[model samples]
Target chain A: MIRIQGLRKFFGRQPVLRGVDLDVATGEIMIVIGRSGGGKSVLLKHMLGLLRPDAGAVVVDGTDITKLRGAALEAVRRRYGVVFQGGALFDSMSVFDNVAFPLREKTALGAGDIAQRVEEKLAQVGLVDMGHKNPAEISGGMRKRVAIARALVTEPEIVFFDEPTTGLDPILVNTIHHLIQDLHRTFRFTAVMVSHEIPEIFEIADRVAMLHEGVIIETGDARGIQNSTNPIVQQFIHGAVEGAHHVA
Target chain B: MTDWSAGRETWPLPARWVEALGEGTLYLVESIGRFGRFLGQAVALVFIPPLKFRRLAGRVYFVGFKSLTIVILTGAFTGMALGLQVFLTLQRVGSEAFVGPAVGIALVRELGPVLTAVFVTGLAGSALTAELGIMRITEQIDAFMVMALNPMRYLVVPAILAGIITFPMLTAIFDVAGIYGGYLVAVMLLGTSPGTYFGQMQAFADMTDVMVGFWKSLCFGGLVPWVCTYKGFHCGHGAEGVSRATTEAVVLSCVLILIFNYFLGSVLP
Candidate 1:
């Protein structure tokens, strides 16, 4: 489980995350929904140890990741995988080489072993035969799939995806949602996703957490979302600006 | 914790001496460590396979190609000026025949490689650092890091390897073009016999002098790009951060190249 305690963050003088706290259980898919500049990404970065809290701690499993330094932090990072907003595939490397990169760099695996593992992961992402393709030559959905494959190649216990479906078409978005659900079910990997596509997220997420005004005001099972009494949750879920979440 | 007390001089002579000595020693040790690691990494990668033929050849073309005309022009002008200045000084002492060898050796041994290295350091060196720095700021370096890769081992080692392996060739090119430029001036403009010029150049300019400069340029090539990229890659704040990193990379590359040149020249046989 990942637990955040009294996490506070700021940019110069303005607070982005104001003493927020939450928990993500092992093997659960949690979707964090919020408006633009609503600190959803900040929360994810903190969890990933890319950003440190000004006042709080992030504990992954039993270790306080915020306090992890050097090798300890790297050890923490190895257990989880991160897919950036823009796929972030190394353009210089082919798709198979990209996925094999981490294995070759980090582990003692031979080239043959690395190649086999990469192929298996690519197959898992349904990117079978496209292993040698360059990222630019592939479609947007395929790049994301490659990114997901690269993320999962190490067989991370937890995968964090930021805006996984942001720029894809609805069909591609639905396809990625299905893939996420399939991966969640097949591997039972803990997944934390930051995205704004509400209904799609509802379809895949085991639970949805709504962050409003620098706080996680609501978190519950997908079925319980429609009946939320919190105005922030209701408005954010339905895309209604009249009740709460000022459009400005 | 940068210490200001160490910079002061009002203390007792022994205390002041100790403080200055300590600071200087630390500086020397740190610089040595940095350069030592640079050499270590370069030496190790010199024999590695998957030699990145396309990328290495591409970088060589860029670093060596785009700077070719500029290096030749700079080299030629400096050569002619050195020849003229040497002529003036030698005429006063009746050792004017030595002019050919002196300027030839000077241009070939030190000036050619060093000047070309500096020019390329400013151009290609800064470009490498800024490109990597931009990647760092955009989280591309983080992307590499998250993949359990070492940016130094993967990205840096290749470029440094390329620079060291290619600088000597570029230096040789620079030396030849520079001497040829001096020949054009010495024979055509100054009326010196081509025979005398060639004779003096052959007899006095030894391999040691020329090779020292070549080695220096090779070292300069590796040092400039490595430090520039290191500074830029470590820049972490934002857009302003990347911009600062780019500028810092360029400035540091030039400064370190010149400074190391001075020290290496002083110590080398």
Candidate 2:
């Protein structure tokens, strides 16, 4: 389980996250939804130990990751797989090498094993024959798939996705969502994804958390969140412009 | 003139100048502090375990071997120009024999290392900044960090150590090419006796002169990449940021090289 307690963050005196508290149970997909610039990505980063909170404890399975440093911190990070917004594929590397990077760096696997594992991950992501191409040669959606393959190549215990479907076309977005759901069902990795795809994301998320005004105002199952009475939640969910959120 | 006083009346000119000066000073100090911290981290990480020799070797090839032709050409041209000019000036005084010594000493003591450093800064340093800047904007650096890899170790240490290893070697090549070019001009073109030209250079240009060039190259090697990579690592948002960082890296590396060359020339024997 992942527990965030009293998490607060300030970027240059402007509060981005204010006393955010949340929890993610084991093997569940928790989708964090918010307006653009509401710090959803920042929250994901905090959980990954990429950014330390001003005041909070990110306890991962009883260990407070916020206080860990050096190798201790690295050990925690090694268990996590993150798919960044832009795929963040190494430009200098081919798709195959990009997917193979984590395994080559972290494990003592031999060349044959590494190749086999990389090929398996690529095939799982439906990019088996495209491994030799550079990331720049691939489409944006394909790049995201490559990123996902790289992330899961290490068989991490938890995976984080930041704006996974932000820039893709509608069809591609649905395809990506379905792919993510399929992978989650197969791997059963505790998944935390920040996205704004609305009704589509609701199809895959077990729980949806609404982040507003630097805090999680509401969190519940997708159906419960959709039927919530809170004006801010309603405004965000229904894409209403005139509401408490707009007034504030 | 009627409205100039009103606009200028917000503050005295001297005060405005002082404020600008203060801001510039603060920026400079902050940059120096950041550069020093990065250097310390890079140096410390260089000795750590899991040294990536493949990356280091690639950087060495890129920074040193790839720069050979340009360094050689620059050294040859500069030496030829110096030899010609010195021979002409010494001809008036019936001391043309000293042309070889003048050219050799200047090349060995100063121009060889300093020019090589400037060229490499323009070539490799700018490339490093642009490459890493793109990575920064594209989030590759953050990806490395997220993967439990230290960017300082994996990206920076190899590039820096490569610079340190390559600078002196390139400077030596520059010096040798420069001396040969000087010999070619003084003996073959200017009709100076080969014996006197070589004898005068041998008499005056000692190991200390070459050592000075080596030391300067070593410092320049470390400094250029240090500034370039730091700018790249901290580059800002997008394409504009990458371009700005690359420009800053090149300008700062060149400025630092010239400044340090002056100091080293003054201090070294």
Candidate 3:
């Protein structure tokens, strides 16, 4: 569903993404695992047309989103929903309003229909009775679930999760991961997630891709990645402090 | 490639000064151009269809109605001060009746619009900058983009429209309160004849003066939101960045209000 080729980005003279090339198949969960701050989110943003690459192309389906502008880019984006690392819920809105926002702004659906849809999404995320509460009033895990509900409310064909479980506790992480897997099974939308939840991500991801420095170093099925001989991948999967990739 | 700036420390002091001046000039010019572009985009999107009336009404409440108490209080105090000062000066010259005209002309022509704008810049403008800056830093804006919503239309156009509509209204309120304040001080306290005071004010302060104030208020209304929204939209990351953006928005708005005030004063009449 998405193809990124020769993606290179730099911050001034400092290179962040250096010639990355990867592909994600439709209706599959593609989880990108990498060291902290290794430009995983940057790659996801390129796919969403949120950030234009310094060089290369992010082609979604057939169109190179990198070159698209204004209405064209916006039309391409209509098929996407993104869950930012911090949930990024509008603080001024209640949970119900946050989920209802996309539908309210984009659709011609009646008020009763919009409310029904928003309530259904809230139920899917297991926050059925928490609609009236503000994001600040909810716990962090609940907030993440609210964000997921908001992202999926539009029933987007493609969804991007940028470290959705970064700060959650281990048990909550498992629950959220399972929640995501169940949703994917039900919705069958193509997903590209950037995560640090190593083993947890491995269990859910159909294909695992490891990013190092700036490029995708390895890409394969979850078992193929586990059994692969790549030293960097092995070291990362095992959580080794000193390995093929430097820590500092 | 030659790196001319690499050894700049070895250059003469005058050369360094010249380079610094050139860099400052370039930065200022670039900022002006960028702000002009932002202003253009804001204006273009403001009247587009599917206008979000709820958002516009919310902003009006914030940018206009919320600032009412401060505007009224400030207006009253300013008029009283002006009246007291003018009355004492005219009393010495046996021209106390002229206090009403002097105070009326000053408030309607200069003080009303200028002070109201500065106050709104500090109150509404800074709040807007902070709100937008936080939204930008938190990736809420990115969410808007991915959802196919135009952030400019969602966030900025309403603010600009609310500003344009409310500034004149608020300025008018300020003028009325100020005139009443002057009446209390000059007529009630100083014992000037009420007829002479109002009669002279009506004759001296014409519709042209009122129009001048109206135009100035309109320009200031647009300027405050333009600068504030731009600053917030492009603010740097984190809490410190949001704070800095808010401060810059207020400061820049006030300065521009004063500058526009002087320019319009000279050009309008």
Candidate 4:
């Protein structure tokens, strides 16, 4: 389980997160939804221990990760797989090398084993033949898939997705969502995803948390969120222009 | 109009100016501190275990071997020009035989290392900055961090070590090429006797002069890539940020090299 309490962050004079509290139970898909630039990504980064909170704690499996540093922090990070919004594949490396990088750096696997594992991951992502191509040569959706393959190659216990379907076309977004669903079903990793795909994302999410003004205003199952009475929640879910959220 | 003194603030402009100056100074100091910290980290990582020979070899090839032609051209042209000027200036005193010594000493003590560093800064330093800047803006550096890889170890140490190892070698090439160019001008074109030219150069240029040049080159090697890589690693986001960082890296490296050259010349025995 991942637990966050009173998380806060500030960028210069601007406060991005203000006492945010959240929890992700084991073996469940928790989708964090918010408006653009509403600190969803920052929240995700805090969970990954990429950014330390100013006043809070992120406890992963009963250990406070914010206090962890160096190898300890790295050890916690190894349990996580993150798919960035832009894929973030190393352009200097071929897709094969990009996927093989984590294994080569972190593990003592032999060359043959690494190659076999890379092949398997590539095949799982439906890019078995495209391994030789550079990341720049592939389309964006394919790059995201490659990123996913690289993330999963380590067999992480938890996976984080940052706007996995933000820039893709509708069909590609659906495809990626389906891919995530299938991967979750197969791997059963505790998934924490930040997205803005709305109703489509709701289809795959076990729980949806609404982040507003640097805090989670509401968190519940899809049906509960859809039927929520809170004006901010109703305004967001129905995409209405008139609500308490408009005052901000 | 009646009470302008009471309405207006007493020290608004001066206060604002002072505030701006303070902010700028703080920013500069913070940047210097960050660079120093990163340098320490890179140096520490260099001596640690898991040295990456393959990456180091590749950087040497790129930073040294590929940079040879430009260094040679710059050194040769500068030497030829200096030879012609020295010969003409000394011709007035009927002591044109001293042209070889003048050219040789200048090349060995100063021009060889300084010119090589300038050329490399423009050529390879800019490339390093741009490459790393792009990597940063594209999130590859963060990806390295997320993968539990120390970019300071994997990316920076090899490049810095390669620079340190290659600069002296490159300066030597530059010096030799420059001396030959001077020889060509003094002996073949200016009608000076080859024995006089060679003998004077051999007599005037000693080990101290050559070693000083090599030392300067070594310092330049360490500093140029250090500044460039630091800028690249800490560059702001997006295309404009990368471009600005590349420019800053080149300008800063060149400036630092020239400044260090002056100080080293004054201090080195």
Query: What DockQ results do all the predictions give, each relative to the true complex?
Result: 0.21, 0.41, 0.60, 0.39
Judge candidate 1 at residue A95 and give its lDDT: 95
Q: Which residue runs of candidate 2 sit more than 4 Å off their true CA positions?
A: B1-33
Looking at model 3 chain B, which ten-residue stretch has the lowest summed lDDT? B1-10
DockQ of 4: 0.39
True contacts kept of 1: 0.26
Per-residue lDDT for B185 in model 2? 89
For residues A1-248, write the lDDT of model 3, one tens digit per residue.
89999999877556789999999999999999988989998888889888888899998899999999999999998899888999999999999999999999999999999999999999998998899999999999999999999999989999899999989999999999999999999999999999989899988999989999999999999999999899999999999999987877
**Candidate 2 per-residue C-alpha lDDT over B12-74 given as tens digits, one digit per residue, 9 for 90 to 100:** 889778867987999999988988899998998877788889999999999999999999999
Clashing residue pairs, backbone N/CA/C < 3 A, model 3: none
Ranking by lDDT: 3, 2, 4, 1
Task: Sort every candidate by DockQ, greatest first.
Answer: 3, 2, 4, 1
Provide the lDDT at B134 for model 2: 92
Cα lDDT tens digits for candidate 4, B103-209: 98899889988889889988988899888988887778878878878888878888899899999999999988887888889889999999999899889888999
* C-alpha lDDT of residue A139 in model 2: 98
Which stretches of candidate 4 lie above 4 Å from their native place?
A241-243, B1-21
Residue B127's lDDT in candidate 3: 94
Comparing 1 and 2 on DockQ, the stronger one: 2
The TM-score that candidate 3 achieves is 0.95
lDDT of each: 0.80, 0.91, 0.92, 0.90
